[model samples]
Target: MLNQTPLWKYIMVLMVVAVCTLYASPNLYGEDYAVQISAAKDSTVDLNLVDRVNAQLEKAGIETKAVALENEQILIRLNDDSSQRLAREALESALGRDYIVAMNLAPDTPEWLDNLGGTPMKLGLDLRGGVHFLMEVDMQSVMTKSLKDMEGDFKTSLREERIRYRRVSIVNDVVQIQFRDQETLEKAEFFLKNRNADITIVEQGELTLVASMSETKLAEIRDYAVKQNITIMRNRVNQLGVAEPLIQRQGADRIVVQLPGIQDTARAKEILNATATLEFRMVDLDHDVRDAVNGRVPPGSELINDQQGVPQLLKQDIMLEGSHIIDANSGVDEYGMPKVSISLDSAGGSKMSLGTKGNIGKPMATVFIEYQATNEKNADGKIIFVPEREVVSVATIRAQLGSRFEITGLDSPKEARDLALLLRAGALIAPITIVEERTVGPSLGQENIDLGMQAIIWGFVLVLAFMLVYYKAFGVVANVALTANLVMIVGVMSMIPGATLTLPGMAGIVLTVGMAVDANVLIFERIREELRDSRSPQQAIHHGYDSAFSTILDANITTFIAALILFAVGTGPIKGFSITLMIGIVTSMFTAIILTRTIVNGVWGGKRLEKLWI
Candidate 1:
């Protein structure tokens, strides 16, 4: 009775280990090098598309293992990396822009295991080889835009308050307002200072009020811009079909993005580097477009060209931004032409209502704006990104509009669909330029996996050997628990959707093996001490486990807290390592204390012995 474990508890422990083992089995089957073919906006994937792909691959003399349609897409399994590359190139060339033929890794897990919701833990970029991008938020652009917005707000506020000002402009990064006289300027300064505490207002000359944001306010803007861009980048990355992409803030103004399963760096860049947004503004009906084109651009008006190269004068004031769009769907309208139905958030809806309530029968143009990075650098050694604006759609407001609207001037369904996708993904707050980019091939990822696996295997084997020789009978029990701990780690990682296995995470597993045995070491030493004090084998074993548990629990809880901190503050690989370390801590605790004790009691408990093997 001293060392015996309850029969029901023993069965429960076995059941847990068995379930973990079942989930862990999928990782062993590995993955296949394949290409995924899916439909684009104006294309469809069917048997005919598959036939065309087969013909192209055959013509190119590329060998493929199999081509099958699954999940509304076509998956072509290839022999190795070479064939995967060739197959993708051939398919892309044959399919043209209509279909998307991207590199994909198909899981080779058995159908039965897959049906039971068993999946391998996803690999990180470092372990799986993909594209990595280091993007820097354009803080200069952020400050400029913030000041521009502030200038607009100030003008609007002054007009609403009936404060007279001759002109309000931004010069040398400072917003300067020339008032009619000192009384108005003084009133404006006092009103602005009280209304916008973050904005610093100063008297410039006799009748001018100069305003600029305080340092703290500027810093807040920069932080928000970076954070917002990171959020938008995450939305864009989802559209790229990446499984485990890492997008995290790096330093103060830069972001690091790692796509673990993507091999196409060009496609990723095309989506992430450019910031595309929509601006809704009233068409300048009162201004002559020809006059504005002749170097006479009106105040608060801009001359923007449409897609057909027609110069159109539009109001500079923005009614709504694309960032407020909550949803968009592409379809045909009454004339069977392409259109996009849009839905806005509550604030956007209110703003839309305000902008359109009095502007009925007036045309509102949707300007598609994109910031593209150029090869030239500015004085700050940062890449220059130029904005490209084009009026894509111009529709007259028939009635008061709220959250819902439709754009009908799109040239094709493809364009309509693309517009909808971008709107749904949300727009970047500020432009971001790719300062650095690198692509990791699957081969390199495989090499990393192989090396990481070797380290784990070697560390594990050494641990097993050391335990067996030093502790003898109890060492065998410890080794069994160690093995179970490793299995449970993999199983738990596989079961958790957010857990991704990286190169550094494997090192965590190696560390866990040692910690798993350390608990057993404490218990065995306690047992030896009891035996030396002339205690019976059964009593020694009982006191040994009971006494060591407290110390083990204390050590593990502290270590678990440390791991949590690392996970909370760390990024990328550090996060991956911390995650595995945390999982390993929990599994090791169960195996070393409860599991190993259960095993030890069942093997050597309730024995009458004078001496102990441990």
Candidate 2:
């Protein structure tokens, strides 16, 4: 009669089958030496662009692995692993043809992906060669948006109800409105509540109405802002060609972003930090900057530009701040001048509509940027106060915008393109200085890989010899499982997206190989003890596994806890080590506890009498 194998044996066989089937194929991995073409951020992308570009590459006899569209960017993979010239040419052609916004090459494709493909699980920056960014959210902007919304609602409701207010001001989180009397304040409060305004009346003095946005409403606004931040971060990371980046809230007003295998750290930083605002403001038809620079203006006032090609003079008022800008991009105007295309939100569109209505025939200057020259407050003193301001005009803005906007006095084409990328990403709150930067050249990575391979080979030889001697025949079974375990781990790693196999992580895998055999050692030793006590072969096998289960569980559980600790506290490569260590512990335990036992039982369970080896 056929007796079915135990549950553990079935699982082990299934795992062996899966590992073999998944990793044994050649085309499972991504192509080597491939360049990725992407879109400029905040710009729409056409998915069919990949087919068009691939058609061109195919003519060159280059086979592409896959064409993936993520975050509106098309990623093209091809052979010729180190053909930078070819990659650059292909990328530029694609960009010139409007197939992609930008193109870049990761020094190397992810090692595991190169051998295994099809949506591999991506690794985080800590586990791969990538960028880690800690970005500070503009809480002030969030609060300001809330205030503005509150003010708009208040003004609209007051006007409709005929409630006259002498003044309205927002200080701290409170909105203070000075009405004529207490009756007016009470009436205004009633009107506000009736209109369903999310405001709380804090004080109603003789002629003042103090109302504040509700705490719940403020919290809701903050939550909304956080959601927006996540969306923006995801969009930016995708555009940068990062695989499965992790962008999550670290604190109330901070986001923690982890990008894997991103070569351009500065570009990644720029993308994550940009606040893409697109605004159209009329040049102050009132002021002249040329005259002011020549000492024709008043004591403290300055000149600036509007959306149209004109200069204006007034108090430096940002009528519509960055929050209203929905999107922006760089393009060439009809005159072949570099210009930025912008889209406004409904409120901004309304303002723009009103500002430009019937004023098209008149001059309308677009102020591209605000330039404040760096100078000492007292001509060589240390104290730095924003010294002077000048508004850039439509023509100046166009010239300065670069590839995205051609700034008039760009030093070179490179400078123009860089500025264009910056604008597409968004404007920064302040200048972000790179205090630290390190580039990992391909040569360095290759050297590390060579050393890592040598170490792995040595480690495997050592573990195989150790297992062969200690457990004897049973030890050989353990070695087989260990070999298969290594293969499965590699296959699994390759299958994971963004999973980078760094040197430290490889070390973790080596360490796991020894640990993988420990469970088999425990079980085998238990079986030997049973045999020594004259137990039957079947009883020996049963008791061995039953007695060893708790020991293996406790040992692996402690190791898992340690790995988790390392993952939580460590950063970069150390964290990579922790992740691999944790995964290895799991896969090893499975192979040892399940796979080793089945082979042992099948081989030695019935034949071994106490006299054979004891």
Candidate 3:
């Protein structure tokens, strides 16, 4: 009974290997080129859209393997990249701007596996091929927006405090306020200083007071903008249905985004660069829109076009910005009409409640603002954002609306869903300009994958030959365990969410192969030492495993700690490496100790042997 294993251990090892094998089988099916058609702001994607897509492809003589409508998007699977490109071009030309025609790689997983919630391992940009963008946040716009908000706060605070001021305006990057007297200036300065801790307050002479952000505050603002933009970008990219995307901060004000298995650069760029937000403002019914259109715009109002391109006058003061919106969803009203349900934070709820309390039956306009990059580049070779504003909805307040409200005058369900998506994605703190863009072709990705696999295969072959030649029968057990270890690694990775495999991750896998065999080497050497002590085969096997347990634990635990640190502090490729390293350590430990011992026990346990193959 020295080398005998418990029945439960055998069952656990078999169950793990079987489950891992089942989950890891999906990777064998590979992927297909798919043309994805998503409804734009004004378009609808239903069965009719799928029919139209099929018709358009047929008319263009493009062959498609399948067409399906899912999640309000049409997915058309094609035979090759050439067909995908051709189909996308034809569909784009036919659909115009109503739909976003993008190309992606769709998994060819079988229905049974899919039904079981099985999916292929997520591949990184380098392995699967996609677009990479290096974006720089417009920190100047961030500062300007901050200054404008401060200017509003300053005016409101001064008016509430009964302090007289000629005017408060943001000139350049500084907030300038002209007070009537030195006493008012001193009082206002104290109030503003306490309220605006991020800004430095300066009194110019006796009547003018200027406030600007400190250098440290500016840096903090820029960093926050970059980080916030990264989060928003990640949310927006979810619309692309990417499995695993990389959106992280790079340096001070830049972000790096990599979208794997996406081939539509134009649509990806549009989604990433789009800076959409909603603003609720009072409809300036006191001002005549005709006069504003005639270039006689009012001082405290602005003329803007609605979604139909009709001009309307709106108050310059914003009641609520999109940033306050916490949740949004597309649904139907009591009359079953399409509407967007919106929820706001406490501050936004208070602001809305106060703003609408006095304006019962008054018209409130929901202004949609978007900042787009122009084709023109500046001297610094960065794209400039051209601000475009439009009134998307104008509705009369029926009651005092607070945190929750609905926009029911949408043109279609698609519009409602789009508005909800924009609200949920959250507005970017500032516009982002793509300073660098790169596309990785599928062929190149396949080549890299091939090279990585080649390295793994050669390493595996060399290890197998050495073990078989030296350890004989015991080497066969180690190789089987090694294979099972690899399977479990892939299985665990596929099971986990957001665990993507990259090139560096492939290197980690290769490294794991060597480390896994090293564990076996330690046990085999320990067994050899026991044999030299004149112990029987069963005694040697049991003592070898028992003696090597502590050494294996110490070594693997140290390596695992390093992997954890790498995953904690590292980004991008380094993180990829760390993830695989950590997973490999876990799986290898199980295979090397539990699995190999189980197999060995089943083979040679409770046997009286004079000599051992090992």
- TM-score per prediction, in order, is 0.82, 0.62, 0.92
**Candidate 3, 1-614: lDDT as tens digits:** 78888999999999999999888989999988899888766578889888888889899999888999987788898999899999989999999998888889999999899888789999998888999999888887788876776676676567666889998888877889998888889998898898778789999866999988899988887786787788788888877888899898888888999999988888999888788767888999887899899999999999999877899999898777777788999998898888988899997886677677778888998888889878887777777789899887787888888999887777777778777887877778888888899999988999989999999899989998998888899999999999998899898888888799999999999999899999999999999999999988889999999999999999999999999999999998999999999999999999999999999999999888889998
CA lDDT of every candidate: 0.86, 0.59, 0.88
Give the per-residue lDDT digits (tens) of candidate 1, residues 179-259: 888788888888999988888899979788889999999889889888878888997776466767888898889999998
Scored by Cα lDDT, where does model 1 land? 0.86
- lDDT, candidate 2, 1-614, per-residue tens: 11225777677687664864465333244334445665542233566666766676766656666667644556665555444346546656655633333334433345564445434434434334455666655555568656765665566457656789887777777778888778888787777776555667755666777777677887877776776667655756766665566666665666677665665565565555444432234444456667765768754344653324354654332334344455665555566655555555676555444434434544433334422324444343322223123233233321211111123333333334444554444432321122234444445555666677788888888888887887788778888888878776776665655455667888998889878877877888898898888877677777888899999999899999999999888765777788778878977887887777677666665563544232
Q: Output the worst ten-in-a-row residue range by lDDT, candidate 2.
A: 397-406
Question: lDDT, candidate 1, residue 115?
Answer: 98
**List of clashing residue pairs for candidate 1:** none
By summed lDDT, the worst window of 10 consecutive residues in model 3 runs over 152-161
How far is 589's C-alpha from truth in model 3 (Å)? 0.2
